[model samples]
Target: MADEVGTYEATVTVTDDEGRTDTDTLYVHVEARDLPEALLSGPGTAIAGESRIYTLFGNAGDALLSSALWTLNGEYQESEDLGGQSSVSLKEKITFEKPGEYRLNGTLADEAGFQAQDSMNITVWSPTAHLLVTLTDTNSPVNESEVLEVDATVENLGQAKSDQPVWLTREGNVVDVIPGMELRPGETADVTLEWQTDPGDAGTHDIGVHSLNDTDSGEAVVTPGGGGDVFFAVGYTSPPPSTVAPGETVQPTVEVTNTGTATGTQTVVMLDIHGTPVESTEMTLSPGESRKVTTFSWTPTVSDLGTGDLVVQSEDDEASAEVTVQGSTHFDVEFASVVPTNTSKITPPGPHDWINVTVNVTNTGDTPGKQDIRLTRTVWPPKPTLPREQKDEVQNVTLDPGESTEVELLWWSPRTSDLQSCDGETKCYLIYTQLGIHSEDDEEYKMPYDRGGGGGGGNPPCTGPNPPPDSWCGTPVTLFSASEIEAGDSVGVSVKIYNHYASTEWRGVNIKSHHVSSYGPGSYKNWQAKLEADDSAQPGQKIKVCVTMESWAGSHLRSNYDPKAKAPAARKGSFGCSTIPVVDGGDDGGGGGGR
Candidate 1:
């Protein structure tokens, strides 16, 4: 089956059917044959005086008649009948137990009278004798006062036993000589060496073992001598500056220094602001070596304040130190302002009239803060007058140190007799500023607005003329329902947008109901509105811009006004409008119109 050039032959035999049989042979021609090459199965070279096994195989052309024969230096010794085959396998285990060169020959014979032969050269190696040693100990970074235990293991991997003396030494000083110890071939021994390490310097030291082997010697590192005669002081660096604001982290660095002549190991520990140990680590310092050992970092929570400390201690030696940490200051407020002084504007008859109030905020804290402030105006004594309901405005602001900013608060009253009649009477207007601390970033300081007595009897005395038509004004917009909506049901909404100013500055009006997706202005072309009235309005009911809104049950009405354009030169008055709740399908009609 091999591709290498080799000879092959076929053998044939003839036999008769008689009680006795006679055989005849046909000789088949064969090409030149190749001998089985000899190969050593073990290592190429063996140790001198050591025994080894060598296996050999012979390759021939035909398996029926091939036999293998082997010779050493041209002298035949073994022959194997390969069971009538062209290839044969042979084995020879020879011991060049001594160091020297060896030559071998192998040959194969085939039935076709073909013969093949091959030879090989081999070498034997000598054995080397030497000793191996290692050191073992549990104590590391030894302290000056600690007992240093040094142990060694010695092994002989040579032809002869080692009758050598092993000695432990430190800094060129002999400590102990292991006497009467002899290690035979493949033998091992353990030796213990104890020394009270008192090197006067605090740093690294050298200690080792020496083996005297007749005329040769070997050395190995045994002990790591640190912490000489000096003592190591364990302590942390100064604590990081404290009084830090919330969300800030501080890291304090610690160091260990050897003040004595000996080198030793030390343990460092760090404690958080609450006196709780947060970190611990081990460190080794050499003589005169000052190692910055540990670091402690702390991040303060929103409710945390004041001072803290970090403590470090040495485990090998009883020594400790403490460092102190400090904390930061914070402050915030809500400020409110009303535009068009209360004593300067007249009350309008409709809810389309609007008043502008500004809420100012500031951060007085040593650190910055954020805030969410809301502005709202509510009418006293609940009644459906004009756009009767509380109006809300919200703002979020961040303030820096001593910084302040203002947000505008808007309100619209529906055009109705009840609201107009109570303007300077039983119904008092309240500008309520709900100041909340959303975060530490707001710039306004809030004051109490609900006490009723602070800003002048809760009502402004009679003021100036009613606002002109050219100013910004609003109309009644309402969302009504038949009953409280339940889960999984849709309801309808109605919206109304009205113009109440004396002068006509607006081209048209637009109404949008957030709860209902569809909304727009009336489609009348160039229709002049003058002295208008919603004849459909009922007693105790106000005129409201209405529309049908469809929504899932439990939904509330959210509506807003969007002007078609800036107020025109003809209309210059500011008006207020209110959001009202009404019947689901009733016409919220009524109003006075002017053009």
Candidate 2:
């Protein structure tokens, strides 16, 4: 009873004499029963190297679930099993790796020992461009001036969409180009090209294709005497193997034959991508004679993992064969070095200062790989860290063995309050960087900028400015000397200035006024001066002004102080005016300017 579930009573009676001697009643319990069902739900398709989550739904109808187990790719996944529980339902998640078809199986057991199994197919695909080349008729004989057809078939084997053009070439020259076309996963497109044989094109020709990251080629033969006479033919004795692992040795043989009534010589060669001969041998054959020559045995390196052509050729005869070199995948990334060093040092870094840390990563393995990089700055003395963590990602990073790339992580200096604790310490901050590939770590670095704090007692106390004592200043002028002038002594002050305006000339320039701010009016008297512009006073021109003074009261002249100077009315733009600071022995410094 699908819809009814309850206890029911049935009565049975048996009478021997008098038709009503005895009666028996039986009570029965009727309930619904269901088998445990296992259902899998997830995306059916995924790309290679992409992670996808798949869930298994286990349900035990009208019964408490005892256990739920999951299997991926026929392998039992103990970790993906839901422990035995009295709950009616259970769920488990699984992740798939690589491309191809995978089976996800789930088994659900109920408390009654009833079990059910279900499975789903997950198709994992990797977006790869595969190209194939075919001649309409490889064995057909064609005379000079004949037209031949070639086809290039391209397929997308990945889960992503792709649109790539296919180029057709004849004997290393591009003869036709097909416009790019979009192809969904598992889609294929055929591009056909026609080429006419020239008078000199009297032998086998290579018709090939160049497509997205892949190449394929085929051969077409042209006989000198079409359909009437046999001619020279050159071809590989046997086609090269479709694939060979990297570093595996391979020896391919080529056959050169004189099918006509003459003897001929041909060269069998194995060339690299650059047309440089890697292996070659000579073959001479008589009429109707074919000879197979083994050029050389070579091992394909990591750089040789691709499609290449092997050609056997004579003056008017040639044959081409395609060989593919395959290599196993490897994942390896290492830190090469940090640009500008892993350590950066700056004097008294300001709040607005920023330092860029560049980490170099190289593909040290035979295959391409990707990695993550991070940079962190740790402030010392128990201060809050600045820019606690910065992360960068690199995806689909393909590089040949030994190739390298660089990624930059930036660190901005923290506020003064954050680093104030390190003022008296030798090193203020520590920089730690990590390249998240194989758990590699770069050397720890330190930033030692000036921090304000404790000073040795022996040093004199600073009493001049708010910036503190022994402070350094930058200016356009450099003071050489400064000394106090006695009451009876005469002192001379010479000032020099630079004309900074590069584009315009200043006319009627004058040394309008001059004064030493540290000295009061009573300290000097009878100030007379002569000023003159340089003869060629052009932009960036320098001028000199000399002043003589008689002291009325002793005064101090600071060697490194700014002196005031004025320009004539004719000058345009504010002159970069500065004071020459008094230096040792009362010598004054010179000033510079630019408009």
Candidate 3:
């Protein structure tokens, strides 16, 4: 039997039992199946001209997979089994000889008559080059006359080889190269170079290293020499001797010379007296040079009585010299006394009227020397009355070594009623005699004596014998008052003028008073008064002068006592007055008068 569209059937009978027949029908319907999807691919990037490892992956969507394979730039590179799965992966190691873009693909297959394919983009690039250099010195800061050594290192970090030359130089002088060889990729080399330095001025110098490729260079610094040792001698010349008196001044000179090769500057110059330095100065000296120096002066006093030594020294070099000084001795003369022996009167009157005073003169020292001895007598009022003028008489004599002489000095005091009755009560006349001895050395020795009443009382008559006719004569005059006064006060001074000689002769006379201590702070003018008289007046005459005090207070008085005496007479009588208290805005009173 057959169905619609296309059918076919067949029937059969069995032979033995009942003969029955059966039939069957057959039908057919026809359609096609879908194919498997293609495999997916990706693009690739790489470092150019280098070996790189890469992996490839495949995907076959809804297909029964059997095996997977990879291809680079249209060549079979690798293959992997899928094991009845739908995806596969493959790995490959590739080396690009040139740098550019390339293509890679993957393929997959299955047993069901299905197949798939995938592809990707690839790129390649070139590598970069690196070079490094370093320089080193084991011993640095090289001296001027020393040898200098330096070491250098060079390295290359690229894939290619290098043949660079490394050079060394000092102060622009070219030196040796580093092994004169080539260096491959990833290679390093060390080079050592040496050079000697000549002696030069002390300073710093530069050392340099250079490579031929201009990519490696280095520099270093060095230096060079300095200080050492130095010698001296000094001497001095002795000074000449100098003569100096006890109270005189003398300056001495000394010379110093530098005798060494080196110049020396002022340490010190010492001037000494008796082994002790009294003064010092400084000086500078050059080689073989001499200097004359006036160090200092020496003045001898009474304490420096004997010989002494003056030494000069150079304190820097300890050089010294000595000089000598000498001293002398002195002698002084004095007259002790001059007294008469008897009170008898003479027939022929002597030049002097009064009795004698025997004089005794002595040389105080033992040295024997000639001297002109003079005896002088000064009478007050400076003029004469009656028989003779009150003049100063001088007589010359000689003395032996350590010897004394006794001579007579005579004077006359006329007998009068007023003088004789008041002899003890009245102020008598005084005579000042000074004995002086002169020598060729111009040295003078003076001895002054006083004969008068004590204070204001009169002196007694002479009771000794009359002197010889040729004896020296002396006159006596009295000083009654010489005293100080206050401001605006009157100053009256009285002195008795008398004659002591037997003959009547007139003599010119003058009076002077030196106000040695009566001055104030400023300059002072001299105060003077004068008087005149003849010898025919009376046996004694009175002379008086007045002084007026100024209006300021001073340290000194208007009158002074004898400077040589321990105690002197006081100013008294009407010529003297008590100190007046200085009053404000009042007129000063005048000083009292004296008889």
Candidate 4:
């Protein structure tokens, strides 16, 4: 039955040596009953010089005296008042000077003068796993290149595993971890780690080994000898392009500085990821000097394309940066070197018949790639004839790496009415220059600065393309004429040759072509040529002139071209009798310029 939990005063009566009814009374402080309990705990085995903790747990049966008595091997050691507590724990720290077995006990007392006791036996012995470090070599003086070896032996003699690894320490700083020190009960392992001698390692160093449970130490003496005195620190690298083709030569720039006291000479090597040297450059630098090396360049073969590294190495130090080598298809393009070459792009207006724009594209990669160049025209401040038109023309060019070529595209020119509308407004053709796939740059083919009310800077208003040379103009009735005049055939007439080009900036291309598309290229296909060839007196009006075409009468073509005619062969004229196919002076157009 469970005892009631409360404090109570009780009387105990006893009579001794009294024949009559005489009683001696004593008062008892009664506390609730509890089972006498005790627990004594300590390590069953411990190393002799190591302090270990022993704990005692006990329950005062009735909470009376609440005192505990401790003993070792039945010898009275000490008494601890349990503070009259029913249940309490007491702890003591014990250290054994000698290894042996010892018995420990905890006795508890209750209010009824009853005693209950708990006893435990602990076995104290030397540690199971004893670790020792030995510096076998008496390397009295070690050279910088000399390697010193330290051996550590660890044996786990207990029934449990030991996890503390044996480590070598220099001035208390752990310098190396002896591999495979984890001992499996009764298993022993030995490990060794090295300390390489250096020029700065000339003085004495305290080297020892250690573990958690038990430790034994030893030392090594190293006297300095000749070794590395120079150290190099790598700073930065200007790596070659990540991608390249076979036989592509690439340059890698590496910066290295000598941080040692001595003048250091070392080689910076460019190597494949596999550590194979691809190229090397050697430099000699004073202490604290940095040198950027670019003398070494590598030519990669098809077989050499892969990831690589650029390494700066000296006798005692090394540093590296990662680089890559592979074949690549890189796409890039620019508009006149991009952004009007840095400003908004603007070009002179093209021929009246059609707008022709040329772009120069270069493949700058090391591998062939495709470039799709598109020219688009979108008229702003839209006009009726222009009709907010968007015409897209794309030309695909496959260029070998390092190859460059010129490409040309054409668009329908703005009609006379469309140009008239742009006279007073910010209305101009917004020509978008598209290179590659998504990149776009733009240039403007703006309206003429002088948009005279008379049309085309005062030249006759051209509703449609003027008659192309070599065709109808040769005889007047026909619109387009024969490609060339027959031999011994000569003819001349008076008519209007309207060359109402807006500005002089429009060169290298015919500007006055209208109503039709004419591609005479280098041919003197404009009216200016006709007036130049004539020997007769010139007309006073800038646009009107007389042209006598005695087309090298005997030779059919202008076999005997008159240099005195002063026609520019490069920009203005072509194979023709005298000047360009002569234009017949007109009566209605007067001396004013005609188109």
Candidate 5:
């Protein structure tokens, strides 16, 4: 970096392992080097979880670069500390976890601390999972009730593992997203998605799954009747109501587009979940033409309460959107998926085990309401006279219209007596959760094969205990923690911690955010980690928080372990978390995502 330019004499010598020596003529050329400048090259459009290599060449890869710093801004903020003075190359691969517009900036600094900066604006897409979708059914001219299976081989080609949902698409539309695919780097998984054919359609139907990235080119012919040169794709133009009173009129507009190469006239009909036609309208459209038709005022009665779908069918294609109908009562509860928190087993649930179950419920009524949702457990296909049903839990649910909430319940695994009435040959014994006049979801558990031997952590809780067993004695793990930490003007942060295990006593807990506020700078022993974000943090910038728990003379803490896997289960009378967390219990141990 010096201004002085000079060439000095240089010498070169070589020596063999033996006592032998050789010399060659050497020349030296020296000149004043230019200041380092940041040069960055990468794709402007990137897939969210797909890693792409980017290069930062300082002065066209000739400068004596001391360091190269990479920073992401705009939709999100990220700083990559890359490239030291002795770095062999400036090429680095980066994977954006979320879809957003980000300015990727690169800075190169010289030994004198002189630096230059360059950047590129990149837009990330959310289709991070690459899937090769193909049909598993070989039946031709299939029957209406015949099930068509879609095999989507989804692969996580990225460098990181994620629990992001893997959505199944049909005709370039998302029909379902299988949650918890949980793929690791270079991992491949086979997800079987079902596409049930419409009930009374005898026509050549074109059905296919979406590959998300527009790479899935496979399609399967569902039924064969008419060789239609003219086809129509149908969908809804206007959305349905969040909640509709009983006997009230609902008219959602349906749109049909001509995707075939010929001009065609087709009747678009509104149907129910059972493919029962409720109303119909006919229209003619040229190729690539779209026309809208409203459903003739369909009214729902009290019997048609709870939730249903607004299904529209035109020709061989159909699309549907969820529609909810509220009864005379002000509240209607819709049950969603159930996630197990603080649990050791998910598949083939063990008996007599203590586990926390998180139930997602949404209020789809017009007005705010509070009511209790009861979860019951009985042998599947319960016979009233036999009467072996067990009333498990009754948790109060309160929410405004269209609002969803999670309720955590402690499920004591069913003992041998619980499964006595059900026949093992039928194999329908399972857990059930329901509310009055609303639908419910179920979870199944199995009786441990070897109960006396007490294997696989399936044995019942210890009745007589002193210094209990290993995991029972003290297997300390994070039960819950904040999802995010938010700090701003007048920022008052509060974090809560609750222990699920009675024996595993937490000596201390702490929450630390990115910026120093009223709280201390770093993590300290405290019950809560009430921290704030930096004042300079802009939109999409993440405020990171650290939640930790110290166990006094116990097993080492497990961080961010999935409840679906073998780890720890919650004890009775213990609720909430961040007594040790990384799990989002019913109550979030900390704040959530970037705010």
Candidate 6:
């Protein structure tokens, strides 16, 4: 039984009848009992339009193999299925027109009535395909329910052409669609879409354009208050503390722009979930004017752990924004030591001195945390408001449950003015170090400290009061901060105005005119501080004034404002201005551009 499937010899003796007298030897042949084995051989992988060889390894055990069969995917194959010789070898050459997986099989049967079969898989690969989508110039503020025009560009970067359809969606809903139209390799095309939102579509909406394999998206929002030639568009909304902790209050604001020729009043409202009103603010805007209105601050409780809408409305127009209310765990951090080293200084205490402060922080809280360290130098006494301040911060400092780390922050010196003099021979600058603990999960926890005074330990010599005997003491005008904005946009400027009258206190003092670059000192429309109203300063006192500037000209600008000075001699002070670079953009025709 062990020696199977082969020819065997058998012997027989004719002495059975006589038992011993006559003995005859006879030989007999034994047939093989094993079946023929069929083995199929072919490449496991191939490219479309390429030819591959498939062979059948066949054998019959001690017997002739009379029939050999070939099949593919359960279908029978002819003798010359691949234009090859029909023999026991059964070799075939095949080319697949399409890319996919296929099975090749072969079966062999011997004359002894036994058969065997074998199979193998072959894979075909097609060319590569890549699709890309792009959105351009989506930075302009869009109003709700208004017609928005956008261009979606599609490009094929792969070797194959695409016949898929491209779909454009807004807020997850398909708004526009286009056929691929067979884009060749490295080909690109643009599809323009004109989309108009429903009147009730007043919130932020994301628009996306996508193909089967790629996608791109941009965001837009609509504003409220529009009817009969007057339209108020909500331009922007910023939700502060995008993520908030439980029982925490956050201030959020909504900005609206008037794109009409006349002035109008609009009402903006904010609401939490459950149809409860939060805050409402009324704003009057002139033609081409845009104003930001702040609603009542919102406090989110533990039950408000999800997302809610903060809606703003004006007349028939409406806009809505999403505010996320989240909960978090508490953590704490401590400041161990704060050491400051002066690396460089200007003789007159200019604004560019390099002062490095090294701070040692420890995670004293129960849970591990990351700390935020900030160093600030501000002037005291709001009367002589040196609006200027120098600040630096280390954003994130990591620590273990009981670990400690040291970090460094840099600050520059504050600018000095002639009207403001140091109380002593040295000028006084108040230093403060603040430690904040914030996590991905919760709001920030803060600890504050007044680190005492700086400016060479005592006080750096600062410009002091000079009595008016000769041409009113020269008042030093300093530009504190100015917002660098894009061309065709508006910015707020903070300037320190000093009182220079020796014997007289100026009343009804206001910023009369201002200039940006060589553009204007035009009439004032909207300002943060109204000096002519209830605000005033003494002879040695300085006040901070915030002036908003707008220009359509695309260039860097410097701000200079002239204060209403009673005495002609006090007006001789030269005003220092800071340069703000305006980004490039054509006029949007919002009508707020400087004339």
Per-prediction count of colliding residue pairs?
A: 107, 19, 21, 17, 14, 15
Kindly indicate the candidate among 4 and 6 with the higher TM-score.
4
Ranking by TM-score: 2, 1, 4, 3, 5, 6
Winner by TM-score between candidate 2 and candidate 1: 2
Q: Compared with the true structure, what per-residue lDDT tens digits does model 6 show for residues 163-257? A: 76665556654444454447887788887754544344566778877766567888876665344244567634665555666677877677878
* TM-scores of all candidate predictions against the true structure: 0.27, 0.29, 0.26, 0.27, 0.22, 0.19
What candidate 1 gets wrong by more than 4 Å, as runs, is: 1-144, 147-228, 233-243, 273-276, 299-304, 308-440, 443-500, 512-595
lDDT of each: 0.45, 0.48, 0.42, 0.49, 0.49, 0.50
Which segments of candidate 3 are over 4 A away from where they belong? 1-241, 247-250, 264-273, 282-284, 289-292, 315-336, 343-595
Tens digit of per-residue lDDT, candidate 3, span 454-541: 1111222222345332111222322223332333333333322222333221221223332322322222223233222222323223
Worst 10 residues of 2 by lDDT: 551-560
Stretches > 4 Å off in candidate 5: 1-4, 7-95, 98-105, 108-152, 156-187, 190-316, 319-595
Candidate 6: lDDT over CA atoms?
A: 0.50
Kindly report the root-mean-square deviation of model 6 from the true structure over all alpha carbons: 29.9
Model 1 weakest 10-residue run by lDDT: 551-560
Cα lDDT, model 1, residue 287: 82
lDDT of candidate 1 vs native? 0.45
Number of the top-ranking candidate, with TM-score as the measure = 2
Residue range 532-588, candidate 1, lDDT tens digits: 223353344533333211111111111111133221111111122233322233343
Give, for candidate 4, the lowest lDDT window spanning 10 residues: 550-559
Better of 4 and 6 by lDDT: 6
- Count of backbone collisions in candidate 6: 15
